[model samples]
Target: MRLHILGICGTFMGGVAALARELGDVVEGSDANVYPPMSTQLEALGISLKQDYRAEHLQPAPDLVVVGNAMVRGNPAVEYMLDRQLRYISGPQWLGEKLLADREVLAVAGTHGKTTTTSLLAHLLESAGLAPGFLVGGVPGNFGVSARLGQGRHFVIEADEYDTAFFDKRSKFVHYRPRIAILNNLEYDHADIFPDVAAIQRQFHHLVRTVPGNGRLIVNAHDAYLAEVLAMGCWTPVETFGIGQGDWRATLVEADGSVFTVHRGDELIGEVSWPLLGNHSVMNALAALAAAVAAGADPRVLLPAFATFESVKRRMEVVGEIGGVRVYDDFAHHPTAIAATLAGLRAKVGKARILVALEPRSNSMRLGAHAQALAPSLADADAVIFLHRPELPWDARHVTDALNGRGTTAASVDALIASLRDQAQAGDHVVFMSNGGFEGAPRRFVDALRP
Candidate 1:
């Protein structure tokens, strides 16, 4: 089938384009502001990408049009589809019809670890000779492509609870039809739609309802919310995993640098070490392991693959270092994610001056709903530099002070970069952590340090 997608530059939309191409679909797409990496990925798949959305860009009647959740009714292609009475669906819904329905789908869902967990599941299955098809939001360094269509029976995907699209208000994962659902963790997010934690929980419940009776549910036993959900009991077979004892649990053996191991666990049917850091990553690994096992991947076959796994891009990704003060970037905007990332960095490097550069850029974060969570998340940093100059939904200064007055400074990006350059010395870790690009602050910061 031929397909045209709107807003295909997003990581997930680009992934859909790749998946569509691999599945023998003639795929094309348009985005308002197309940029690197994803644009390159789409082009490599031979998927046509138009820079700006135009109604005319819709070519001779395609079988379907996949609309990204970010694309609204105002988009030209979207409007054209409606006016022409052409068939159109959300990206996830298209994927559900073409790839997920009836097939064994190992879905990783959470506020933070979904990408890593999904990527880990893909890696484990591929190594086990499953050649598993996958669609992950972020590019896993292990697989050059974010989405791949293979002959294997398994389909692994990142199951986000975010809204599907303007037309479909349901969670995107609701369309995935997961057979083995990994509920990594849940928290209040996507403030645009959700009023609080309970609202997000309902979205997750909707996803759980999609799983078949034969399917299995593996949840973070440690997450109080997921724990509560499990107590209520859904129809599918359920298992638990986390720091606490459960069906699949991870006890950290050692974390020397960004390397750690599950000291013990029966879910893998064997004890094995992983090459990623943080308690969060360990939990993600366990979630992936459970999903892989549920999909019939041999515990032994995938165990060895974990040792050679490389970290994904922008999750503690060090882009450059000058005179020992490293400039790194991460896509952690949620308070939980930000805190976990900082903790991981702290464990990897010792006693170094860890400067936490922050931006409240995510839909929920930008609105400052989680203002209370901001301070404690940055406690790991030696200093906190927050960008809240243009305007803040609330007083960011007061929030920083609430955490601690010392070493907290709120400045514009330019001023923050200047301050970092002036104070940067050997052994300092300059972390630019935000979901968005933070206005290219990472590149600008590195350029400032270059002699």
Candidate 2:
């Protein structure tokens, strides 16, 4: 089959492209801005990529067009496809119809931690000799590639709650009817698409409705929102995990927050001492462990995999260090995510100054929907620098004003870099938070910090 994908540069769409290529389909794609590492990954697969969306790019008229959520009604390529009456489908639908139909799908879904949790579960299944196929948003350090077609019957996927496509307003996860579903946590996000927390909860309920009666729903025991989501309706067998509650739980072991003990209903399972930092990560591990168990793997036997598990790239990924100052990159744009990331870093570097370089890049953040909550979220950080781009809808001054005295807004990437270079001390951990590249500011900071 010859397939053409729109918005192939996106993580999910790129993964679809790669998976299709691996399945022996001729794949080609186009996007507005194509850069590493998805671009490089696609190139390595010998898939041709076009720069921008144009009708001419569809000259060959492949057998099918996989539309990404990024495409809108007026996109040139989309309009062309519609005008020509060519067959098309959303990425999730195509994936469901193609890859997940026969496999036992283990899906990880939440407002945050989906990528990491999915990657961890896939790694656990791999270690257990399941060799599960997976399609994660971020590249797991354990596996060099983000998407793979494994030889096993299990398929682990990072199920996002975002809309499927322009034509389809429903959440993407509804298309993936997984046998095992992990609800990490729920919070209000994607302000552009969702009106409020309840709206997102409704979508989550829709996801729950898709699970078969014999399947399992592994959820965070302490999350009030997730509880509410489950209260709506759930048919699948459910298991919960948290710090101190649920059928499964984890107890912090060491002061540095790198070690912890796992428990299942008061029975000590095992101790896990990993390099992953923060309580959120521990919760992610618990969710992954529970999901793996639901998939027929033993937590006691797979405990060693948790200890050696390498985290997903860009999730507190340390880029470099200069004069003892460490620079980290994270894909945290939402207020809840920012808080979790900062808290995790604080747990690891107690008493050490933690500086944050933040970009309000996501559509929700750009709309200022999360502006009021932003300052309180960064309260754990010693200091913060905000990257203010003019294109964003909200005013950066409003965010700075909310911070009282702990925050300063930089109008440009260069200004943000200079501010970091001057304020960051030897013991400071400079963390850059954004879903996008932040104009390559993370690397620029590391480069400037280099001697």
Model 2 per-residue lDDT tens digits across residues 268-356:
99999888988888899999999999999989999999878998889999999889999999999998889988887887788999999
RMSD of 2: 1.1
Best by lDDT: 2
> What's the distance in Å from true for residue 21, model 1?
1.1
In candidate 1, stretches whose alpha carbon ends up further than 4 angstroms from where it belongs are 59-63, 255-271, 389-391, 406-412
Model 1 misses residue 201 by how many Å?
Answer: 1.4
Residue-level error in angstroms, candidate 2, position 126? 0.5
Local accuracy of candidate 1 as per-residue lDDT tens digits, 28-117: 988986876788878877888888888888867678888899987777778888999889888988889877775678888888888888
The prediction achieving the highest TM-score against the true structure is: 2
What's the C-alpha lDDT at position 230 in model 1?
61
Taking all chains together, each candidate's TM-score versus the true structure is 0.93, 0.98
lDDT for model 2: 0.92
Q: What is the lDDT for 218 in model 1?
A: 88
